[model samples]
Target: MTDRSAAGTTFDDFVAARSTALWRSAFLLTGDRHKAEDLLQVALVKTWRRWDRLTGGVEPAEAYVRRALVTTYTDWWRRRWRGEVPTGELPERPTTGRDGPGAVDVRRDVLTALAGLSRGQRAVLVLRYFDDLTEQQTADVLGVSRGTVKSQASRALAALRSSPALTDHDHPATEEEPS
Candidate 1:
């Protein structure tokens, strides 16, 4: 079956090329693999609905999809359901020794720190640092001013530094004696 959008490119082709990157961004934004998958799916569906209107090519289409993802996430944050009850019990861990200790620990700590951030702060950090977007680009993505992006990034970094899971108290002070 031929899979082609109105832009003369197949949706499958676009997904094949960019799905991994999109999924990574989604994971960073959502902080949970399952939520990330759902977020990506919803964004893609929204993008597909308006695929034909995405002129100028794949880049524009990707931009539209990213905007959809961010907007959808923001909407979800606003209407977050409070009906779900949290269980105090911790889930059983599988003893899989695949990743290196340092790498695994760092990844876990980073994700935990990210989870500690507010939605806007987390979005800014993910877009500016993890996605490697410029301040202006991040602002554009989140539909905010560059100044807002800068402030959010600053606050997010401060929060991360203060996170007990991410802080390194072992470092010695480097202050020099006054001359």
Candidate 2:
């Protein structure tokens, strides 16, 4: 259905073009594929409800949706619900023949480290690094000061570096300066 809005873009068209990227951001924010899908759906529905209000069209709508996604994730984290509990046994990861075991290991390690971060810290990292948003933009999205964004990102990176999952083995050694 070609349901075009006043902004000259159909919701379907917007979703078709942007859903994958949105989903990736959601996954990184939530640290689960299933939760990512749920979060994206919720954000998209919220965006669609006010799609016409986004006068700048798709770009503005995307920004709005991204902010909604982050806000929703933060809300979810705050709600201390007894959600799904993990068992002692780890689940098997599906591997693509293209990426080697090392790649998978690094990816897993990074995700684990990210999951350990506080919601605000994780949101800052995802928006700043993954979404490639400027510090000002990230602060605007999170409704915090630019300094807060910088501090959060710094703390997040420091935590990641010190995480056992992403230790010296996972990183390349830098050359030492001669004293």
Candidate 3:
């Protein structure tokens, strides 16, 4: 087998290939665009520092970066500022465009519902459902047990089910199964 360290696979190449997916996961975790950018940057920096050890294809690098992202995000939650920072300009509402206001509202409502969850619960939901990671994968990313992942997912789902914002809407966060 050719040594990947001798082969191309630069950190830049890895970032170029997976930045969008990483950024989307960051956005899901942070629930804000700018924070997501910061999170992704931090994770990439961590990955770059360990790049020599992460020398496979993009998969290892991506996995390492994702773990960094979740760990950093969990750390941020501990000391996160409760007070809102004032900005000079109000952030513009996302244009509904052809999808219309309902689509935007649904997105907003779901985000709001997610925001209501505890950090662990939110992380589990994002990593499992949104990122489509398996139970073991999510547990590995968060450094928790598979049982913890399942329980957190159950609690997060139950919370979302009972969320007033989602409950009021015609479309629920999760589709109800037939009785």
Candidate 4:
């Protein structure tokens, strides 16, 4: 048999092998399918750019892609034209022409709670918990010190715990506002 791929792998084959896992990571990072697709596209572009540099194997390629995804997500939030997608578990609205006030309230609360976080804090939490990055990896991904990552993560969790969205489980209901 003759060898065809110089690196012994085709780009299309690589995409086929990794797209599912990559899509899952992207979803966790962006909290929305649309944003996830955008992130994945950016990651793929970066992967293509460095394909030769990633000749070590899939492990290196995967790491490169992950790093790209995380960095792209961080930059996206920092953009003036970008907005946070809703990060809650519910349908947007009811089909029966109902106000679905409770659903709307819940969604708003969740969105507000997440918004309470600094961009760095949110990225830290998502990278650490959602993406399951080690503290060191998260720090590297965010281009910050590990100490900064830990502090931001602590503050982010504390804010989530204190958010009125959480209080809804026991306290009186109230209208939510953006953070």
Candidate 5:
């Protein structure tokens, strides 16, 4: 699909182009595929309702949708059911040999570490680190001050560092923050 300027972009085109990336962010936020689909759909519906306004405004459609995603996630977190449902058996899939052993374990540990964080901290980390949004952008998406973003990211990283699930793994060098 051709990339169009915001003024020329249709809601359908924007969804076709950005839905995958947006779904990835949603997955990171919700940490479950089904929940991510729900979150993404809700955010997209909100965006569609405001398509003209969002496309006409200074911000891009993506920014509006991301903000919607985050706000909706926070809202859901407040009303979420805390009880767990038991499953009779685990779903099995054939593993690829490419990632080597313990990759699944590492992923599980990372998710566990992320699950330990508060919703705000997890949102900050996902938007800032995984989504590669600037601190200001993350602040805008989360509707918080830049200082709040910085502090939350700091606390989140510290918590991850101290998480028993992650301690055994060697961390790579940190990337320099953008100015």
Candidate 6:
């Protein structure tokens, strides 16, 4: 195997590969576009510092970066920082640009439901459902256990099920059927 230190030049390739995915994850978590950009920027910086260890690419290069974004988003390092939410529902797409309208409102409603969760509950839900990881994998990312992931996901979804904004909308994407 090549020296782990010998991963190729870290500038353009890394940015090209992972930026959009990271931003989407951030936007989903924060429920705002500008904050998503800032979140991805900060996560990239942390990833760059650890690139040599991460660029091995044995698994998705994105996994490490995504974990960084989630962790940084919750850290107490920014105690003074505050995030903004539109008094109304978030725009289906960034007003700075545009996207298709179909099903966009559905997605926005789900995100609004997620925003009502506590930080850890939201992280567990995003890591499990959106990222399509197993309970074990999601637990690893959140530094918890499989049981914790299940428990937290259940709590998050129960809260979501009760959200007024989620009325009459099915979130099969984020929940499981009971046996």
Q: What's the distance in Å from true for residue 148, model 5?
A: 0.6
Q: How well does model 3 score by local distance difference test?
A: 0.78
lDDT, model 2:
0.81
Alpha carbon lDDT at 81, candidate 3: 38
Query: Which candidate's lDDT is highest?
Result: 2
lDDT agreement of model 1 with the native: 0.76
Better model by TM-score: candidate 1 vs candidate 6:
1
Report the C-alpha lDDT of model 4 over 53-78, residue by residue, as the tens digit: 67766766777787788788778777
Clashes of each: 0, 0, 0, 0, 0, 0
Question: Candidate 1 on 1-179: residue-level lDDT in tens?
Answer: 13547477778888888988999899888766788999999999998888777777788888788888889988887777223232222232443576444554555666776777878898998888877889988888899999999999988877776676656433222344256
- Give per-residue CA lDDT, model 3, range 7-43, as digits (tens): 3687766777789988988887887889999999998
Q: lDDT of each prediction vs. the true structure?
A: 0.76, 0.81, 0.78, 0.70, 0.79, 0.71
TM-score to true structure, per model: 0.80, 0.85, 0.81, 0.67, 0.80, 0.77
Total residue pair clashes for candidate 6: 0
List, residue by residue over 1-179, the lDDT tens digit for candidate 5.
23334577877778888898999899878767789999999998888877766656434788999999999998888878344222222233345698567765665667677777889999999999988999999998888999999999998997887777676677432455466
lDDT of 6 by residue, 1-179 (tens): 12323156454566776577668778777776787898888887776667677655524456777778888888722463445443336655542335544456666777777767888898887787777889988887778889989999989978887776677587444455666
- Please report how far candidate 3 places residue 47 from its true position, in Å: 0.7
Cα RMSD to native, each candidate? 4.6, 3.6, 4.7, 7.6, 5.3, 4.3
List model 2 lDDT by residue over 133-166, tens digit each: 9999999999999999999998887777777766
Q: Model 1 off-target regions past 4 Å?
A: 81-103, 168-179
Reference-based lDDT, residue 124, model 2: 98
